[model samples]
Target: MIGFHFSNYDPRQSGKSKFDQLLDLFTQLLTYTSGDVTEALQWLNELDKKYELTDDEYGMGDFIDELKEKGYITDDEQRGEIKITPKTEQSIRKRSLEEIFGKLKKTKTGDHQTYKPGLGDEVSPDTRPFQFGDMLEQIDFTESIRNAQINHGLDSFTMQEDDLQIRETDFKSQTSTVLMIDISHSMILYGEDRITPAKKVAMALSELITTKYPKDTLDIVVFGNDAWPVEIKDLPYLQVGPYHTNTVAGLELAMDILRRRKNPNKQIFMITDGKPTCLKIGKRYYKNSFGLDRKVTSR
Candidate 1:
């Protein structure tokens, strides 16, 4: 695991403080453990001894105590375990999402499709004359007020158009999304755990689309020896397998999944590192660990 370090801090502007140094150190530790904070701290202890770091000035122990004190990390008393705070998780997620998705484009309209206010322009084929059951917005307000004034007396300022209001219609947009995740052996090979970040992104995106875009459909497929649909909750525990990359399988599965979706708008988001290494022949899996096979590439 590579340790990450953030060195962009401006001591002049933010002050050359211990907290900043600790943040830098914590980031460095994250690179090593991919934010497996407890494991990183344990490594930090070993590193402190190997480097002979000053205990009073730059001690990992002190830094962790400070981290817990400041709520960046917390202790689960019952579990006897230290865990990252919700704040840290959210910050890491925001940073990770921004890094991968880039910035969300700013636009005049809302990100998602929204219906126009008031009773939609689409009216029933039969337009009945303004009646007691008709919506007020459907009723021409001016004409209604005029009718009320005429029917009542001059003192009948209490106008009655039956307080008609528009009956709002609903419009639905069809959206289909294919979320691709790489499950190549490199994800966890040589002790680097890139899979964690990938899994987190998958989980977050799944949660986001499911909760906020009820009208839209999101399909998650993992590509390794073969691509298949996996539930969102399964993501957090997803692990890299010995199987090599079969990107074609992933794409094929994604396309197959999208084909089932009748939505007019379809999009695919693939997350992968390195090239393809395996392909399938009928029901048999063709293994290739050295290089990309042109046959698979063409597929």
Candidate 2:
């Protein structure tokens, strides 16, 4: 008989190479540094010094060279600048997608089905007598045949319109979503890094919509003293500013974006840590960061 053995697992013994491990940390640091490759690398170097991340055989220089050779970053000798490439941007998004949604159990691919029955691909269990306008494909032949047998004896063997049964299918709907991220000074306050997680969530959500639900639409809006749209590719470079939280502006922009979408299902997802402290009126701004202003909340 064959026997199996088990032993304690060591992370160092893990299959991932040094380059891959450093790349993961490097990508995460890039998000915090607003996609600045040089800054991210500098942070990585500092981390390596403290944590002994590299050994003599494989080091930071080797990791950097591999990054360039793998097309994740581009070097400009004249400007002496290192920048992340589009491939890196997409890689960050994919990594974020896995980090956020990896825990979810796998399921069949399909759109959200509504309770209301109509023409759809997913068949429902509910059935009713066939209507005049119902499509021929909607007819449940098994149920219809049973109905016919009950209505007419086997000797007679007659089928009628009254014996037909229609199986209703649930309606599947596509959604248009606007994600609003607050990039105010408050987000990075108290030595906590909130903006990085927000960027990760936005990137993950955008990737999920574009890849898994192609029919659905996603729009990203970043709000500071003002609100504006940002492309998916620009998410990694988003930064918070010395601005007050303008929740009203974010909502208005989100609604404006949703209006342009033809999909019937529309929604807004806002991520903010603080209350509304500012509002834009006419050409000026009304700001009261001390606390929640009644004037701002009323609006």
Candidate 3:
């Protein structure tokens, strides 16, 4: 929703303007700033001056004004600080989708495949010979008749497997997906920024499911000692806490959420770099971090 000149949209292109580079830098800045608009702007300003990112005509102040004017962010009345608006959250999700999964072709339905045929509104160009289980409507009568005539000529005619061509189609089925992100302290430990990329990827996958597969339901959960679901808007600010990895808790919560969905197609995606170091047993936390804990992994 941040209104910038559409001409500067493609930063990867050969000739990017000053605004394009600034925008790209700003998006990355949000990851470290944790959705603090004011702090992010400050960092952007500093970098702008050092790198000469902006021109005299298009300055950092101009970009800040554009962000506020476009309703991408707003002031938190209670906190009296600049925070990202819903529009900004949506834009972040979209940008993440492009950066991560831009190479994927947009399908009309879910990404998975189904054996059922003669379904879905959009018909595919491919066709196959009619099988016993094929629906009557799936049979291409015109194509079948044409084939019969060509094979038997005008003298003889017979309906056979070679003559029957069944049109193939894609079936749209609702799906329920649970995405679990590991947010234990190790995610940010060793002086690395792993959580940010993970957040970006999670946001991208969430957006992909919401927009490309409207019939699908996506739930995101982060696990440290305990696991809890997170809203899409809260993804950008997700950070690792001083907590141990609780893989079991994350899986339990994800399974619980997926159990309520009506969709038959259900899946779980987990992104993590370390082994489980903690397990919850009836409210008590069992922690271990020295080496691979077989007990935690077994769970």
The candidate that achieves the highest TM-score relative to the unseen native structure: 2
Q: Tell me how many clashing residue pairs each candidate has.
A: 9, 0, 0
Expressed as tens digits, the lDDT of each residue in 1-299 for candidate 1 is 69987776443355656555556555455534645677877776776577544347666667777888878888889989787776665544444445555576765533354364324444323333345654545655555566567777568566654533334433445578999999788888888778877766775676567655777898889989988888654554456777788988899999999999888789998877778878888888887667767776777
- Arrange candidates by lDDT, descending: 2, 3, 1
The CA lDDT at 204 in model 2 is: 93
Predictions in order: lDDT: 0.68, 0.92, 0.83
Kindly report which residue stretches of model 3 are placed more than 4 angstroms away from their true locations once superposed: 1-21, 103-110, 121-141, 147-168
Q: What lDDT tens digits, residue by residue, belong to model 2 across residues 1-299?
A: 69988897544677888988898999999999999999999999998998888999998999999999999999888999999999999999999999999898878756777888988989899999988899999999999999999999788988899999999999877899999999999899999999999999999999988898888888999998999999999999999999999999999999999988888899999888879999999999999988778999999
How far does residue 50 in candidate 3 sit from its true spot (Å)? 1.9
Candidate 2: pairs in clash:
none
Rank list by TM-score: 2, 3, 1
- Could you tell me which 10 consecutive residues in candidate 2 have the lowest summed lDDT? 8-17
Determine which window of 10 residues in candidate 3 has minimal summed lDDT: 5-14
- Residues 216-283, model 3: lDDT tens digits: 88999999999999887899888789999999999999999989998878899998878899999997
